[model samples]
Target: MNLLRPFSLLLAGLSLAASVSASAAERIPVVASFSILGDIVANVGGERIAVTTLVGPDEDAHVFQPAPDDIKAVSRAKLVVVNGLGFEGWMERLAQSANYRGAIVTASAGIKARERADDDHDEHGHEGHDHHHGKDDPHAWQDPQNVIVYARNVAAALARLDPAGADAYRKNGEAYVAKVQALDSWAAQQFAQIPEAKRRVITSHDAFEYFGARYKVRFLAAQGVSTDSEPSAREMAGLIRQIKAEKIKALFFENMANPKLLQQIAREAGVTAGGKLYADALSKAGGPAPDYLSLMRYNVGQLLEKIRLN
Candidate 1:
């Protein structure tokens, strides 16, 4: 070959090597919108992906202010998973700001929603409102039945990203869904022991619409689904009035909200502040409720025991 041709081939080889080096140096960074989503991604992604959470455990994502490091994580992530139900309003802003090009997987898509309480009894505009009041509740996984859908959604998304681990992700999802079904059966069995009249519960936030709807329990709350939205004074007053009228036995606090509100509500309503609950996020690795399975068991089991005692 000619000398110039040999030199040109050498330069091309060097350029290719540099590109491969840069690409190989990058890890498959994954970002989750919040702690619960992060936990789900971790289960499905396993060790193949490096996962980061914009909002950590017990943080209200509705009001979360993501940090610089959090932004960096998202910017570098190859995939971003979110529980979309207008839950993470800031996600779009952050993703755009970071200029991330990752695939977005919304775990809540295709889930059957519960009607919002606001629309439940609003005679003012009752005719044609959808599940926002009639059918669309964002907290589907609270019902283990809905978590099966979440698992399938998560598995499909992860498989699309990394086809190599598709088998593992699928198996993990199925196994997890089976566990969720078991938990659902267990929760129903535990709650069944309670008298129908005593199935009423009071929580700090309205996070249990799905749980209540699925298990046929009544979850009266002092606040709405998100702690970020402050309850109107009239709303709070009305809740307190209803609690007293109903003789609601227990008043549990969400791990995410300001406990002061629930504490005040409990004191005003003349009910002892009840057990701690994991509504918004999984408890840290070794606290009261650890993983998803343990977390659900602890929450439902505690409620069962307390409702009986009260």
Candidate 2:
């Protein structure tokens, strides 16, 4: 009865598909080193960017091995963003392999870097030998205030690349910065409710020094800064003694780290392991800590709930 209707529908579908392709083509291609940084870039760039994250959710970037697809993504990107501060030791090699000529933006560019110290050393005073990234603790993103700087940096970089979208980028960056500031204020208030003596925590690695400094909470780790570093038996023994003597009860495993080590520590110290903290990466899309803002809130909430037990 309506033989022409099917042909008309097919033509309309093709037009819609072409429109979508054009829209995607108009967006700038951006490559982020990890999921958390990719989320920040997405917030800052908004609809103007198509972001490709090399390190997916809950994946370790410290020992990440880029595949051929990653190289292609980098090569095709108009811009690439990294956490910097030695967090991406493999980034340089990957870029070389990709022959990426685009600008690489360091989100933590202007922030004052935290230098690795005794926090990276175990109880027996053994330091991490993998200081290939130097003495800087690459986990600056642990601090929400630092992320404000990250938003600003990403905005500036994107503005430089896509000058036409400068206003949009700035507005987006400002909005993101406001959200981060609010988060920082809330976190400060939350920590204020806890006594100074109960603010101490134990984790698998020294990835929270920035967070510790920001919130004034001390973090003791079983291993050093990098996850690749193994703790000596003497070091673990010393840590166990300290945990027992100090009665520290807030122990957590990072999302990207091996939980076995922290689990063993908890068992030895006779303390129940708390919920996992998002340190180096975000959780999956459906998980609690899917983005940077959510990640911080989840971590702070978890820490508060558990540290109260100390």
Listed per candidate, the RMSD to the true structure in angstroms reads 8.3, 2.0
Q: What lDDT is obtained when candidate 2 is compared to the true structure?
A: 0.91
Query: What does candidate 1's lDDT look like per residue over 208-287, in tens digits?
Result: 98888776777877666656555656667777887788787778888877889888888888889887989878777678
Q: lDDT for model 1, on a 0 to 1 scale?
A: 0.76
- Local accuracy by lDDT, each model: 0.76, 0.91
Cα displacement (Å) at residue 102, model 1: 1.6
User: Which numbered prediction scores highest in lDDT against the true structure?
Assistant: 2
Write candidate 2's Cα lDDT for 22-126 as tens digits: 998999999999999999999999999999999999998888899999999999999999999988989889999999888999999988998986654645456
Minimum summed lDDT over a 10-residue window in model 2 is located at 119-128
Q: At residue 142, what lDDT does model 1 achieve? A: 84
* Weakest 10 consecutive residues of candidate 1 by summed lDDT: 124-133
lDDT of 1 at 139: 70
Q: Clashing residue pairs in candidate 1, if any?
A: 113-135, 113-137, 114-137, 131-135, 131-136
